[model samples]
Target: MTGAALAVALGSTGLVAVGTPAAYAVTPSDEVAKLPIASFGAMVVDDAHERVYVTDGRRSSGESAVLVYNFQGQRVGSLPTDQPVSGMALSADGATLHVSQSHRMLTFDTATQTRSGASFVPYDVTCGRDVAVAGGKTWFTETPYNDPYCDRPDNIASLYGVSGTSHVNTGWQSQGRLKLAAGPGAPDRLVVGQAAAGADANPFLTTYDASGETLVRGPQRRFADAEGKGALDLKDIAQSADGKRIAVADGAYGTRLLDASDLSDAAAAYQPLPDGAKSTAVAFSGDGTYVARGAAASGSTPDLLIQPADPANGTTPLEFAFEGELDGLRVAPRGLGWSKDGTRLFAVTSNGNGGLWLHVIKPPAAQHDSRFTGALGTTPAKPVVGEPLGIRGRLELDGPAPAEPVKVTAVRKDADGTQEVAAAKVAADGTFTVLDVPDRLGEATYTLRFLGDVTHRPAEDVTVTVDVAKAPTAVELTAPAEATRTGGVEITGKLTGQGRALPSGIGLKVTRTDRFGTTGELTSASVAADGAFRVRDLPSKRGKTVYEVSYAGDALHSGSSARATVKITG
Candidate 1:
């Protein structure tokens, strides 16, 4: 889709859009700072003070530190740490910033530019990624480095909590650990995703109550599957303001949306990018209307795709293509603070020198929409069979709301490469339902076309792919063997795999071969609750007849039953 089309689609959401830029402008004013060295770690923004914080691990000197800056990219001060600072977090008040380095957590008083009561207690294991602060405590992921096994033991991957009130020399105490327990809310508890387990790693998202002793494990969200194809090496996570949703950036899965209410089944409910974009950092807009995902790249020209909360209705995201190189390749998003009004977004990055890059996310001009916008707010670019893909969309009139009715059509191309199936006249609410698309051989693209009543403009189309069965299976046919000549034919069958029912709503095409040496026309049917189908009024020809079942897109066919001779002997 063109950038203009993407903007128009998203404009329906009442948001201002910007056009795509030919090239990013690099002004001397855009230069943030020059780092002391090349190493990079984490970057964050303090929205309250309009300042940014960036950390340099100082792997060479072992005296890592964080640098502070004003919104204009001027370096204000630098706070030094005893060990390498790998991950960082800012308190809600933005007065205290926490840094994790060499298995220790230190609180820095940003106002005083000094250590707050000597860093907090040190952790037992090295942290893998970013840290989050919530409910008066600091949370970090502990992935033990000693384990030789590919998957870290349950104890190796834990969410260690340190009291914000604790002093560094006082020794931070462990709050609680996440584990499997039985109870009404037991399944909701979060666990740590297995580290280095490839696809079999299961990560838990655990949270604790006030006292911190009684552990409340929310749910175990698998980071990777057994095959490692969808493995999610989650690097960063940020929750929406209302805490209703959490956006996680997995190395392999891009960004995953989790329902905070039910953490147990949230992984299964996640929506990932079809293009398999790798996300290095994630931050939710203040109001929770949009999410900004930072792509991990060393080059200055990185494409950041802004995904919307809803994808089914063709809401494409806004993309900001950067012009300069990122100093820190492994840099985590630091100072992720939104404006009080939620209008502006700020991010910090390492420029590979001793300098830091201050990234300001401003709303693009009203007229220009970037290329990344085309990917947002739409259904997954690719929809898997049996999934109840959502579609939330709005119609845009040239001037005012249309005076007459609008017709929305969903056209599904046959997987067989020959036929086209269509559904017309969607409801007034701009909604349509398509079920049981047959498991075709290759990729099938579905287009949604909207026709305005009085407007003479051409119809608008949104293209999305549909993936067919991953394994080969025969199409089952079920119907009455002997039927009355006057009645229609009811065909029914189950699509099974390894003795289990396939995912629901697989579409299939049924055809009949008559003894006359000519092939009959094809008919389509969606899988039902029992995987059964009934097609009435199948026109019968003379002599014996044979019925065959096949998928819509592919040429594969199911085993045909013996011909049932239809003798019309008068």
Candidate 2:
């Protein structure tokens, strides 16, 4: 199921937890900082030093700098660059940071925050490049040519491995911009994907065994279906903590989870993103327990989701909707990174106005148990079809109360099929009422669920079966006590039903019994929109006459009849 949306409130240095009631006061645990750069390029986290490095990717030959921040979201320092900063990666030991530049690859000492070394690259690239620390060496990709031509499909791009004073061209080349992803879990493995900006009808993604002296390509994949639909629109990619799975954020397809070994679809995949959201960034926690998926969404739609790394886990994701001036509205592409302990997530966002923001979030350390403790009770005792019924139940949550009340979702299963009922909000006391109007008769079962939140585990589902009976209907007749034989007897009646409104155009059955004890059928009377009907008849024999009006009920109503006597005189 899609996770619930939580709107985060940003302060100068803190972020208040969402998903709680507005009236509840909350302690700010997360951090948010306004980025100084106008454009976002990449974000790298050094868990050892608790520092985050973010770069400005906009092409500029004049001057650029990598903004640095601590785990607390405070600006710690900056690394000045003669040229624009592009892709960046942190060394496995967290001792060095590799930064990509137009004419060189610069390395920074994480401890001293100073340039450790600089290696010359073969190409002076005006277009930004991608850097990754893989195969026991530093590798980067170059899109030959300058700014405008960077995204051109005809541009040639190549991968190079960095050595002592220069870089080594791996001789592997492709058209347009190429992306690279490598992590501590898969240090010797390099995952690469092509950008759709290259005008490739179908983009390709492949893996390389970087452990050897030379780059060996393995398991290549092209994502176009047979009908030429569903081509890959890659945004960001990441490898699981164990390197057993790879997750790709495709704007056209949401998040695609695949087996890392062969790039095949994983047995299980994460749920579809919220509507109107486009995938932008993805990252796996260093500890392999969580994966953060980011998207470009507007309004209250979530732009970031933190959930279990294992797709099969049913735990609900912790969602964050970033929509504030201090916090960017959407996540930037390739803007997510996590600390080694899987405790903090670093994300970069752009507000579409050239403004960028950085957020450091800490997930809850523990999840408490929640359960439905007692049997559900329904209002009105006896449930009738077409009538509103409230299912009352109590939920026991073991943890602290949520800022906002939690909701309980329910579904009704009947002969016709299953139907979803509106969610019921749980009060502070852990009591809730699920209201639904049963449309079908006979046995109907209501199943209520409480999908867990970030701090609470899911509660065991509880169900209640009910026997639904049809609504009762009645016919009321009004007739004169006496009528001359020469004058035709006229009778007025009304038809009404409990629960749902009675249908219009109801034809009531009418019969007349004369003094001779013989009965004859009269013309049926059509009911008006107000449930009123009229019946008129002329008796051939003048004497005491009985008039009976009856209605045959429909599926949701029970039948009923009424009678009236009129004396006829000559």
Candidate 3:
């Protein structure tokens, strides 16, 4: 609720919905800064110096600067540039930052944020470029054209290795734009994926052994199936910390885990993303303990997911839904970066309207245990149809108090099928109340869930079943003591019911009886919104006459009737 804390509600359609109470922090995280840039090119985290470098790739000809922010997201300084900077990568030792601009490449000392050196690049293209550090050298991609043609399929994009004041053409080229990824886990290896620019329909993903003098290409891969249905739409790439595996963020597919050597599918793949979400960026933490998967999803769908790097670890992910102007709409392409310690995750998000934000998140170092403490209890021992029922339970969570209050989600299942109930806010004492109105009779089951948060693991679900009974309805009648045979006998009455409001325009059955005990059915009386109705009838038989009003119950209420005695005179 204070500082950079945000309250993000997780969508049910997602694989994991980590719901948090409103006005409460979604996680122990913060949106550190609203980046003052129209477009995002790249993000690089300098763990050694506790700084972050973000480039504004929107500018082509005008002078721009690489925006620098401290770990807390405060703008510390900027490294001015002659032209807009595009791609960036941090050196293996964290001493140098390799940045690529439209015309040339620049290096900066991570500790001082000062320009260390510059190198000449052949192409002065405005299509942007990608930079990476591998084999004790700097590597960058060159898209040889200006705007509008940057994404053309026939555009010549080449990979070049920075050598002191000049760049050596690696002689490797691809159509459209090229993306580069490298990590300390595989210092000698560089992974490349063809961007989904108007280039190759089935873009290729390959690796190169950069340890040698010449760039030796490694396993190459294409994703198109026999029917050409699954073409690679590369958005970002990441190699595991140990270099044994690689992860690709393909818009066409979800996140793809591949063997770093053969590019074959990894033995285990992550679960598919929430529906309607497309992969945009991914990164493994410097320590290889976690992987941050970024997506471009709308509404409540999570835009970012932080989970265990190893897919086998079935730990539920901590999800973040970025909505509104302040937080941006979704994670940007290649927007995820992390500190080497694996504690802080830096993500860049962009709204479709050209707004951007920088989020600095601190994932819990350890997840604590949580559990349902006692048997679930329900109020109004006997639940009735069309009435509110409250389910009460206690959740015991370990570790310190949550940054924000947690919530419990509920679902109701009956003969009609299952439906979700609104989430209940957990009180400070770990108590929560799930409220719902039962609409059907017979047995109804309610299941409650606590999906957990960044600091706690999920608690086992609890369920309670109750028998729902129809609501009781009654009719009251009032009549005059006597009436003439020729004159009509008038009666007035009211209908009353419990739980949900009774249906409007109700019609009650009416009957008339004389002193002889003979009874005859009469016209029905219509009830108004106020449940009041009037009846009029003539009594041919003299002496005593009786008028009765009755109501037959619907699916939600039980039937009831009332009678009034009246004297008749001829």
- Compared with the true structure, all predictions reach lDDT values of 0.48, 0.84, 0.84
In model 2, the runs with Cα more than 4 Å from the true position are: 1-28, 196-200, 477-493, 510-526, 533-548, 563-570
> What TM-scores do the predictions have?
0.50, 0.88, 0.77
Worst 10 residues of 2 by lDDT: 9-18
lDDT of 2 at 309: 88
Candidates 2 and 3 compared by TM-score, better number? 2
Q: Which model, 1 or 3, shows the larger TM-score? A: 3
Candidate with more favorable, higher lDDT: 1 or 3: 3
Residues 1-570 of candidate 3 have per-residue lDDT tens digits of: 022223333422233543333444465356458888999989999887889999998845878899999999889899998888888988888898888887788998887778999999976556888899889899998876554667777777889999989999989988777889998889999998888534338888999999999989999998888877799888999988888989999997989999998999999888777778899999999898999999999876777888889887645677777876677888998999998889899999888788988889888899888888889998888989988899999999999878777888888999999888888888889999999999999999998887776677777778999999999898999899999989879999999998878898789999998889998999999999999999999888888888889999887899999999999987
For candidate 1, the TM-score is: 0.50
TM-score ranking from best candidate downward? 2, 3, 1
Model 3 clash number: 0
Clashes of each: 65, 4, 0
Model 3: residue 311 alpha-carbon error in angstroms:
6.0
Clash count (model 2, backbone only): 4
